[model samples]
Target: MPGKPVNTATKNERKLNFWERLYLPEVLKGLGWSIRKIWKEPSYTFQYPEEQWYPSDNYRGRPVLVQEEGKTRCVSCNLCARACPPMAISMESREIDGPKEREPVWFEIDMLRCIYCGFCEEVCPEEAIVMSKEYDLTFQDREEAIFGLDRLLVPKERLADRLAFLRKQQNPQFGSTWEYPRENNRHSLRDLTTDAESIQTEQ
Candidate 1:
């Protein structure tokens, strides 16, 4: 970059051929292959809502507001808020009557501003938060875009699957914040956070 620089080839010499310049031939060839493959395997066109596509390994999608056993892993530490570069996380905490780690009475995540960098999940002392693989997060309204604790809580069945999946994605058990399970075993709500052992919220 400092010197006048070396020119191995001239600009005119780096040009494409007539067909390549036009680009139609290549496009058509790819289309032809795709059409034939789709015809052969109709499975490619996903039946969305009913059947979702397999998410990518690196795809950081929706945030799941996990309640292990019956408690959220988040201790109202605001570590995730500190960790988020985008300031997408907003949470409020309150102490319940019985003994338990502080819980987020109101937890909200602004997906529009989220970087999905997986920082919250990594920095989590309790492993209470995780990024769901499903990325098709579309909403009809802007208000819906801001995922609240209820909206973020993955359905019971999905949570079960995600917990099982996370067991495979291992890391050193967290001690700085709380003891995270190595096997990602199911903890009842009572086992997770609250003393009641199981507190049901209207989902």
Candidate 2:
């Protein structure tokens, strides 16, 4: 027990040296790296006419519903309405000429109050409601942000075109029949360049 007879080191034996404690060098290194990037890439942003930022692959943002010919996306099930966290979504499903296929007579989403939790999209059985990847959505007034049935309604063909892999990933039975073949061109929004040339140019 010669070596273990006594413990000379204290509990706080490990301590940072002057350089480690200061951390000034690390901060300078990071600043230098960022400055180098700005200098390295002079013309990295897109020119509006030439390019644009692609939306995210699995982003859940703005709410939209697929509308077909003479049909609203909602099926009067009231799932989305019931599942809303902030109760921002309002829907009234009524008979669409025929009692068989019910559609939303009244639909409005209060974007100002909407928390964007994607709860409505998850609860939708018909997959009618979904959060779009577009997050730059702006509104001049609070009322304008409150999207109505007419504004929220998106043609199935348009949605299908926007999200090529959407059909393949969704349930076949619950899938929107308005689907066409995949565009076969799935790209991440991060990979695309934003239209910065216009902003960079003179006012």
Winning model by lDDT: 1
Task: Compute each candidate's TM-score over C-alphas.
Answer: 0.57, 0.57
**Global lDDT of model 2:** 0.72
Q: Scored by Cα lDDT, where does model 1 land? A: 0.73
After superposing candidate 2, which stretches have Cα over 4 Å from the reference?
1-36, 41-51, 97-100, 161-167, 170-203
Show how many residue pairs clash in every candidate, following the order shown: 7, 0
Q: Which 10-residue window in model 1 sums to the lowest lDDT?
A: 194-203
lDDT of 1 by residue, 118-194 (tens): 88887676768888886777888888889887777764456565666666566435533445664354234434664
Model 1 stretches with alpha carbons more than 4 Å out:
1-51, 56-59, 69-71, 155-157, 172-203
Residues 66-143 of candidate 2 have per-residue lDDT tens digits of: 787857657777777777888898877777665447877788999887888888876676778877766767899988
